[model samples]
Target chain A: MEMTGLFFYLVSVLIAGGIYAVLCLALNVQWGMGGLFNAGIAGFFAVGAYASAIVTTAASDKHLGGFGLPIPLGLAAAMIVAGVTGWVVAKICVRLKSDYLAMASVGIAEILRLVIVNESWLTNGSLGISGVPRPFADLVQGRSADLVYLAVVWFCVLLVYILCQRLYVSPWGRTLRAIRDNEDSARAAGKDVDWFRLQTFVIGCALMGLAGGLSAHYFKFLSPSATEPLLVTFLVWVMLMAGGSGNNRGAIVGALAIWFIWSATEIFTSRLPPEWITRSSYIRMLLVGLLLQFVLQKFRSGLMPEKSPKIRSD
Target chain B: MIDFINLYLVPGLAIGSVYALGAVGISMIFGILRFAHFAHGDLMTIGGYGVLTAVWFIPVNPLLLLPFGIALAIVSALLVDQFFYKPLRKLPTIYTVIASFGVALIFRSVAQLFWSSGNQVFTSGVRMPMVLFDTFRISELHMQVIILTVIIAIALHFFLTRSKLGRAMRAVSDEPELAAVAGLDTERVVRWTWVIGASLAATAGVFAGMDTSMHPNLGWNLLLAMFAAAVLGGIGKPMGAIAGGFIIGIAEETVTYTWFSDEAFISPSYKSAVAFFIMVALLLFRPQGLFKGRLL
Candidate 1:
């Protein structure tokens, strides 16, 4: 029984790790490829999560959802909604330098939090939406259900990885790199820098929305707490930075490794004496923060550094 | 009118003063360091908790123990810069910004570890408002906050214009290469920037705590408003940041005031959004900000 419990715990970690893998890939597109600093990953993630939850949940008076749409459609809607939000934000903030953009995005995320809390008619205020349906729930039962979700999550991660890898070597990707590495030169070369940035930001946010939707379905519940910046935004950033920002493979590796550390630390923290239990979580957080610093300082290029594709001069 | 002035206006100015203090630091750091210090809000948190810790030991008014908070905040800022930021100085500014994000988490978690996540106040019971002219009512704290801010503003003006270090600081902020070429001590300016910024942030944190209750997120929650002030005043212009802070503070307070009808014009919950909107609008139309500080 203990062995089986450990197996199930590992499965759950993989599922969350897969979701973070997707999020890291999305962020890589913006920050790594396009050099856009999007600090409001949690905001877009919440938009997708709530959008999917509101769409797929069975008819209920508690929130503004009665559509009970198919889970796939809900996911699609999540991406689209989050993409639209990204577009709006990008239109306003894409021009700002890195730090200014970061502050603006943080503000946008805070406003979104306020909307989620105060607009009870739509989001059920702080109560959050429950009974969010999982994909293939009817076909699977008990423990198998989690396994199927794990498979689904990894499949999404694989799909996103392939897409990112393909984009990395493409001419469009080269243009984005040109803009990111040297914006004035890119503009001098007649490339529309702002438009490309907007597109990259939208695509990245859409992927984040997809990740958020997957988590909502996996947990079978959606709430504001699950979408906090520390978990959604900061954690994914750490994963991407640790994994190697420009490499898709590194994103997946970083996600799984960091997710493991994040989860396993909890096991030890939970075993502490009763008095220390409450403070353990904070200690864990401090460790994670320190880990980020170590990774940044020691492993500047991350575990899997990006290898740019060579073009023939002939 | 009396109700409006007493209820909304005074509170707005008081909070605005806090925002100004924090924004001044943010603006200076952004100007001199060339990166948005994401951990700034947490510095304020450290300040509040610093004062609270002193209060616990001395059992005195939190205001009397304000210097302790300032010292604590200054130490944290300098330490973070030394360890995290200094290492990344040669790298891109984005690296520093990202490091600051991690620093923010570290600071917040430390606060949680030292002081439980739950809310705690310096003084448990509320003080009665001071009534003036039988019609006007104001908290003594509010009066003190406003007066203190005014005094700090004047002192800051002199420090900027009169003192050699202050002028050197401004020179570095405006043109770092030029300042360096002029044989100015950049490292000394950087140290002074942290001292002034961290000290003001501590004062703001304590004042904010005194106004409300001290919590782990006391500064984090007010962070954007302070940013709005910094940006509105102009990114690197300290005086402009001060004016921007008061403007945002007053607007945030008065917007919710029910002037036209029996209900609030805007919901009180959306008061935070007011600063955000102002910031977005300014960023869109006037990216140089009101004071034309720095184009970036």
Candidate 2:
């Protein structure tokens, strides 16, 4: 590949990595801080992507889109949709115990994907919706669009990271940890456990949705295939678990590392012998699975355990 | 309406029986182990492949293959338990769950590596369709599924309710620590539970293979439905899982009749989504499931 082409690929991959990192951070807030085992992050992510795509794209007789709102407004709408969906799912499922809640969330995610796939009248069905304009595309020309988009995504990621770090050290974070450690005790101590969980889940899902919206605009396409369970959901779980689920910084680091490995492997696989290349895809999947299992076995605390906030008695 | 019921409902029940068998195994394992064993689906796939392999070599009658297939499935289950589950016994439930997911991915890769991803059909000379009177007709495969399901259900019911080992297994499920303190061999019970559950799952796979074409992804594809059934029936309750499986199967099949054309547009590809929808609805409205009193 040419230098510029390689540069574009690398930057694009980094942008994708940033988007996924945002998602991992969102999941960390839900699973690590709040102890909610949400397996349906992809559903909310997809909802955000579709919400933004529909809102910003020009409406035609064939399909409906919001009246050509600006990208930021569309993204805001996406977050709202995703957050509300998360809240509804949380209200229904958080009342259940751990395993059941996981199952329920996964089920909902699958259903959401199906609806996106089957509701052709609404989502354009499996044919997918395209021609989405990138944010600030008018200002950035041609090859520079990729770099500009990367900058935009990184900006959002940094903002979210700082906000999350603040939350992690606040009183709310203390209450979240208390609920995670012992929900019954938290409730007994006058903490509204369900409300806190719901809050965390919705906020996390909203962030995930915003990440999705960002990606959708960057890619300039929306499809049900983008939200497959194995690719989106399990991949995010792998990132979260691998990165140290409780640590926001770790989540971002893990996302970048995994995406780099994944991209590098994909690029390398094609250059090898055809049969070897064919075999390598399966090997790659197996390696990922084994890596996850190994990580869980050895470093159950993940790569970076979140530091406990220091306490000073007055 | 009566004719439609006869045409659809009876066949639905037969298909549902297959799902029930698989669901029972899933529920039993969850009850005992307290984790969603993702490998359970792949184990079923292994059983189907096992039966196919045996039939390929032996040229035996399909009827005879049942016992052989069940035996092979039992052995496969035992091997998986020994190699995978045994080492992870000391780990947390989530660790085991993730390990099972890995094991499942490994099994899938192995299947892809060895068998190729193409679908395989194992046909025997026994292609006769069973007829229920002149008007009602069913496949021999469907008949086998019904008979096997009933036999397994009766046998398991007897074993759980009337046998000492079965009672011990129940004790362990109810309270593992208490059962251990009460001098019940908890390890032994867990082993037997795996044996029974694995064997039943394999049997379901073999029967399902006979009815439909066997493929690498068949069991994994059926997982959502199996999970829906298990959860709908109450996670730990074997009978509930069975009933939940049947309910899901029949409901999905019946939905085809109501929305046949629209369903066609939706593509039976979304069939898994139907099961997931049912599971989510059940979770939202009745998380404890139909038969269970409360969450464990």
Candidate 3:
């Protein structure tokens, strides 16, 4: 029984890690390949999560949805909704400098959060939506159900990873890298910098939406807490930076490694005295933050540094 | 008229003072360092908590211990710069921006570790408003906040325009490469930037605490508004930030006032959006800002 319990814990960690991998890949598409700094992964994630929750969950008068759609449809809806939202934001902000874009995106995310909280009819407010369905929940039960979900999560990660990998080497991806590396030169070369950036932003945000939908199904519940920027935005950033920015494999590796560190720290923090129980989370956060500083200073390119294809001198 | 003066205008200006104080720091840092400095708001958190901790020891009026808080914030900002930011100065500004996010987390966590996450107030219960001319009523705290901000603004203006270091700072912001060519002490200006920025942020934090309650998220919750004010005033312009702050603060407060009927013009919960709206509109229409600040 203890072995099974331990196994389940490991499975859950992997599930969460897989979701983060998808998010990292999404981010890699933007910040890594496109050189677009999207500081509001949480906002896009929230949009996707609530969209999926409302679509997949059984009829409830409390919130907006009674769709009772299939899990696949819910996931598709998540991507589409998030992609459209990203398109709108990209139209406005993609032309700005990286720093300005970051600030603008943060503002948009905050506004989205406020909307989630204030517009209770749509999101059920802070109360959140429950009974969110998993992909194969009716078929599998108990530990096996978790194993199935784990497989599903990893499958999504694999799909996103493959997508990102392909995009990294594709001509389109090369153009993006050109735009990111030297916008003036790229523009001089007849590239539509703004349009390329807009496309990259939308794609990245859509992937973040997929991750959010996966997490919603995994948790079987959705709440405002799920969209917390500390976890959704900053942590994903740390993962990408720690693993590697431009490399697709680095995104996956960074996601799992950082997720492990994040989860393992909880074990140590849980052992703190009763008074420190409430403060343990903060300590964990401090540790993660310090780790980022250390990583940034020491490993500028991250663990799996980007190795761009070199042009032959011959 | 009295109700508008007492209820909307006074509170708006008071809150505007807080935003202006914080925005000045953000603007200066952006102008000089060329990064958004995501952690500026967290620096304000350090100030409020600093005062809170000091009050525990002295048990005086919170305002009396404000300097200590300011000093604490300055020290913290300087340390952060020395340790985290100074090394990244050579890299792309994105590195520093990302590092600032991490630093923000660290500051908030430190506050949470030391003070706990719950809300803390300097004094219990509310103070009565002072009645002026037997018609208009205003909170003593609000009056003090506005007056102190005005004084600070005048001092800041003089310091920026008159003081040697202040002029040097502006020079660095305008053209760092040129400033260095002109033999200005860029490092010293950077250090002083942190000092001025941190002190003002701390003052804003304490004032914000006085206006409401101090929690771990106090400064963070107001971060959007401060950034909006900074951008609205034009990036890198301190005086512009102050004006932008007041405009945003007043708009935020007055927008919710019941002008036509009993219902608010907008939901109180969405007041934060007002700053965001103003910022986006400004970005769309006039990226150089009202003051014709730096385009970058």
Candidate 4:
């Protein structure tokens, strides 16, 4: 490929990486800090994307909700919707231990996908909602659009990074980690374990929803298929686990690094001669799974192990 | 009434049998080993494809050739345990869950790489429907599924209760530390659990594939619902898997009735929703399930 094409591809990869980075951070807060296992990240993502899509896009005769709202408002609404969904699920499931929570989350994700696909009055069902307005679209056209979006995404990533780092050291964050370590002791110390867990779960889902909205506007379209279990949900878990969950910086770097490997590998494998694509793609997936196993066995704790939770001011 | 029987009840029973088979595996692994065993579904998928591969070469009827699939499934289960779960056996059971997720992905990819993502059937000829209760109709394949399910259920019950190894297995599950102190080879019992569980899972998957169509996602799609059945029946209780499976299956069929008869919120696509909803409700109200299975 030409140098310009290579450069553009790299930029695009970074853009995708930015979206994943936001997702990893959201996961870090839930799993890394609170010890909550949410296997349905993609459901929240799909919800956010469609929620934002409906609010901002031109009203369609076929489906509901096209108020042509502002981009920020759409994003905020996505957060609320995802947060509420997470809260409801947490109230029902967080009482159960880890494995049950994981199963319940997966169920919710599947249900959300079914709703998006079957409930045609709202989501356009399969064909998907399009013509989503990109923020600052008229100002930057051509390749510059991607560059600008990347910067915007990076800006959001940075903002989340600073906020999370602050939260990580704060007393509230310390309490969350303590609760994760031993709920009984934390409870003995008068910490409302369940309530804290529920709050953190909701906040984490809201972040995921924000990331989804960012992804939707950047793509200028929304589709039900994007909420695949393999593509978004498990992929984010792999990123957070591989990158080092507890460390905020680790989550960002891991997202970009894994996204590059995942997308680049896809491009490379698909371009391989026809005789190879069918076989090679699956082989790649196997290798990725094996890579995760190898990482778990070797790194054990992960690339950037969780920083010891020192109870102090940032 | 006959139409309803043919459409809902018979299909529900068939579907429940598959869920029961899969649930037996889930409950056994969860109850005894104390891990979620996330890859159990993929193992089922592997079994179906394993049978398909074996039958393809051996030229045997899929119904009669199930033993070959069970054998392959048992080997895969042992390998999965040795490679993934064995290393982290000492660690928290939660870690096995993460590893199982990876294994699930690996098994799925491997199936796709080798088999391709095609919906395949065991044999081409359609089974003619037979009279069941005067007006109700059942196909040869459907009858075979039910008959085989009953046979397996009976065999499993007998083995768990009467056989020496089966009793040892139960003893270990009840109290591993005490059982080990009492001279039970915990390792042998654990191995047997996976063997029986994997065999049952593979058998279910192979037949489910025959009943419907074999695809890469067949087992994965069924994973959550089967877990629901297992939990509903009680995690460690094998007999519970049967009752849970039928309940989940019937509920799944019943959920779509409103949509079929009148415009309603629950559509056919939301059939999977029924199992999850019931599962959640059960957990909330009765964590031990209808049978006296432990919450864990």
Candidate 5:
């Protein structure tokens, strides 16, 4: 591959990695910090992406959107929609135990996807919506669009990371940890467990939505199929589990590593002999499964544990 | 209305019987282990594949293959328990759940690689088609399903109530630690539980494959439906799972007939969602499930 081509691939991988990193961080907040095993993160992500796509894109001649708002405002709309959806799901699910919650979330995710697929009037259905505008397209111009978009995405990633870090060390973080470790104990200590969980879930879902919006904008298209359970949801879970669930830095690293492996495998395997490459697609799935098994067995806690601050003894 | 009941209701019952069998297995595992074994559905898929593979090798009667398929499914279940579920027993329940997800993924991938992802039709030449007057027709296959469901339910009831080992299994499910302290071999019971559960799931898978199409995702897709049944009937209650499965299956079929113009367009994809909707509704009003009794 040429240098520019390689750079584009790298940028693509980084973009995918960044989006997933955001997803993982959001999941970590819900699952690791709040002890909410949210199997429906993809639903919120889809909602955000679709919401933003509809808002910023030219209003369809037949359907909603084409308001053509700026990217920032679109992102905000995505967050708001995702947050509200999260709050609704959390309210219904928070009353249930873990297993029921997982089942409910999975159901919700499937339902959301179904709505996206079937609601042709709103989301353009299976045909999907395209021609989404990228940030600063006019300024960057031409082939530089990719690089400019990459820079913009990374900037947003850094901002989210910093924000997450700040939240992780705050008093709110301590309360979340306490709740995660022992909800009953936290409740006994005058903590409103339900409210705390709801807040955390909403925040995490908002981040997830924003990531989805960013992804849609980067791809310049939005499709219901793009938000399928296996790809958008299960892949994120795999990334988070492999990276160390609670640690944001680990999440980012894991996302990057997995994306690199996935992309390279696609490239390398396709370049191999016809017979081998023909079979590589199956092999690739097996590899992913094996890698997940390996990670689960060898490094259940992931590559990096979240860093805790030093305690000062009085 | 009478014709509709005869046509859809009867067939729905047969389909529901298969769901019941599958759900019983799933409920047993969940009640005892306290985790959603996401791979249970895939185990059924594997069983279906096993039956398909067995039929290809030995040109046995379809009826004969059913038992063989069940046996193969039992072995697969045992293997999964040994390698995947057993190791994670000491870890948190979440780890075991996650491991099961991995196991399911691996099984599906391996199945896809070996058998190919294309759907396979499993047929038993014993096609004694029962025609109950043109529109209100019932097939021998449907009869077989109902008979099998009844036999299994009765057998399970007897085993749990009468047999020492069955009682021990119940004891373990009720309270593992207490059962262990009370001189019951919990590990042995758990092993038997997997054996029985997997066997039931396999039986369902084989029968289901015969009734419909056997695909790699057949079991996995049916999982949520099984879950709906299990949860509705009260998780871990074998009889409840049976009832829940039938209710869900019939409801889904009926709902499709009532709501949609083309039954084909209704799609099985929505079946899981329908099941979940039912479950959520149940949970909202009655968290303990319909047949409130001893779950495990």
Candidate 6:
């Protein structure tokens, strides 16, 4: 491969990996630290992507997204939209048992997908919205633009990672974990478990929304097809599990590793002889299942097991 | 009126029967195992494909293939339980949920690998729509669906309420530890639960495939409906599941027809959304459902 080609290819992978890193971090915050399970990761991701795309893209007669707002404001609107959805879902499902929350989340994700598919005026139906603007697109073109996008996405990932790292170490973080560990005891300590869970859920969803917005802007496209529940929800979960949750750095490693494995498998599958094509995809699924089972049994704690809780002298 | 009867009522009954069979399986497993068996949908797929295999050999009749498909599905259900659920029985509920998700992917992949994507239909000598009274018509397969579901649901009701093994299964679902202490063979109960639930699932899949065409993802689409029906009637109650099934079935058909104002507001794609909305509304207002089975 040419040097420039290689650079672009590598930068593209990094850009994709960085967006996933943000998603993984959001999941870590929800599942790892807050003990909130959001099975509808794709739904939240789609919400943010569409939200940003709608706000930033030029106005069309058929559908929404005519505002042509700035990218930052678009991203902020994405966060608010995703956060509010999370808040409503949390209010409905979080107060009850945890399992209900998981099932409800799945329902919510499917509902969102249905809306995107059926609601023509909002999402342009199946065709989806296009021409999502990128930051600094005017200044740089081609490969340079990609590099800039990579830097921007990674910067966002790093920003979120640092924010999560700081939040999890604070007293508020300790309280969230406490609520997760034992709601009764947390309540005994005067912690409002419901309120804390709601806040953490919104924060996690906002991060996920931000990841989606960045991903949409980078790709310059948004569609219902890209957000399959199994591909988005289950894959993110397996990544989190393999990378180990709770810790932000480990989550990033997990995201990159799984994303690479997925991409590698796709490339490998594409190159297979014509005869073996149908079986190859199935084999891929089998391999993923086997890989997950092996990972679960052998390294249940994941590659980077969560660090032992730090002693607090306070 | 004819259109409403044919379009809404008859189809509702047919679809409701399928959902009833599926919901019964889901409720039984949930009661006995105490986790959402996300793999149940894929199990239905296996049963559907299993029927396809049976029909290939004995094209004499599709109903004749039912027993064969049920047999294959029973073995698979046993194997899945022995392999996955047995190991994680004592662990946290979440492990089983995630593990089931993995298993679901595996089943779907295998089905897709074998059958690929297009729909597969069963060939019979002649399909005649049975007309009841004057203007009411239902297909033979649909009639068979309604009759078969009623028979199975009744048999299941009797088996769960009257039979010794059925009582043992209920006992185990109620309290495994206590049942064991009381000298009920817990292993036997678990095995029977798997057999019964899986058999019902296979039957449902076979008929659903008969009504429509069989595909790898057919059961996956129906999974949420089964969940809604199962949870709607209250989990663990077979009778309630049947009731929930019919309710969901009629509601799905009715919603398809009923739209806001003049235009088709709901659209065809919102069918699952409607089912999900019902499930959510139930969860919010009446989590215990109509019959009030155990709520986890």
Best by TM-score: 1
lDDT of 2 by residue, A104-147 (tens): 66677777887887888778988788878797888979988889
List clashing residue pairs in candidate 2: none
Off by over 4 Å in 2: B59-92, B124-129, B259-274
The model with the greater DockQ, 2 or 6, is: 6
Task: Order the numbered candidates by TM-score, best leading.
Answer: 1, 3, 4, 6, 5, 2
- Report per-candidate DockQ: 0.89, 0.52, 0.82, 0.75, 0.49, 0.61
lDDT per residue, candidate 6, B1-296, as tens digits?
A: 68767977889889899899998988888888888888888888898888898778776667777878788889988987888778877776767777787788888888888887678888744677878887778887888899988998889889988999999888887787899999998888888888888888888888888888899888877888888999899988888999999899988887767456654446767877777888888888998888988878
**Docking quality tier of candidate 5?**
acceptable
User: Model 3: per-residue lDDT, tens digit, A1-314?
Assistant: 98988888899999999999999999999999998888889999888888888899999998998489999899999999899988877787777768888887888888888888889889888998999998988898877898999999999998888888888888899899999888999999999999999999999999999988999999998888755576568899989999989998998999999999888887777898988877888887888888889888998788899988665679
Q: What lDDT is reached at residue B5 by model 2?
A: 57
lDDT digits (tens) for residues B1-296 of candidate 3: 78888999899999999999999999999999999989988999999999999999999889999999999999999999999999999988888998998999999999999998998999888799999999989999999999999999999999999999999999999898999999998999999999999999999999999888889889888888999999999888999999999999999999988888999888889999999889888888998889989978
Pairwise DockQ winner, candidates 3 and 5? 3
TM-score of 2: 0.92
Candidate 3 local Cα displacement, residue A51, angstroms:
0.7
Of 2 and 4, the candidate ahead on lDDT is 4
Q: Which ten residues in a row have the lowest lDDT in candidate 6 chain A?
A: A290-299
Q: What are the TM values for chain B, all candidates?
A: 0.99, 0.91, 0.98, 0.95, 0.90, 0.95
Candidate 2 chain A lDDT trough over 10 residues, lowest sum: A59-68
Badly placed stretches (over 4 Å) of model 4 are A312-314, B258-265
Q: Which stretches of candidate 5 lie over 4 Å from their true place?
A: A274-278, A311-314, B59-63, B124-129, B133-135, B259-271, B293-296
Per residue, candidate 1 scores C-alpha lDDT tens digits across B129-152 of: 999989979999999999999999
Please give, as one word, the docking class of candidate 1: high
Clashing pairs in 5: A57-A66, A58-A66, A59-A65, A59-A66
Instruction: Give stretches of model 3 more than 4 Å off.
Output: A310-314
Measured with C-alpha atoms, the lDDT of residue A313 in candidate 4 is: 62
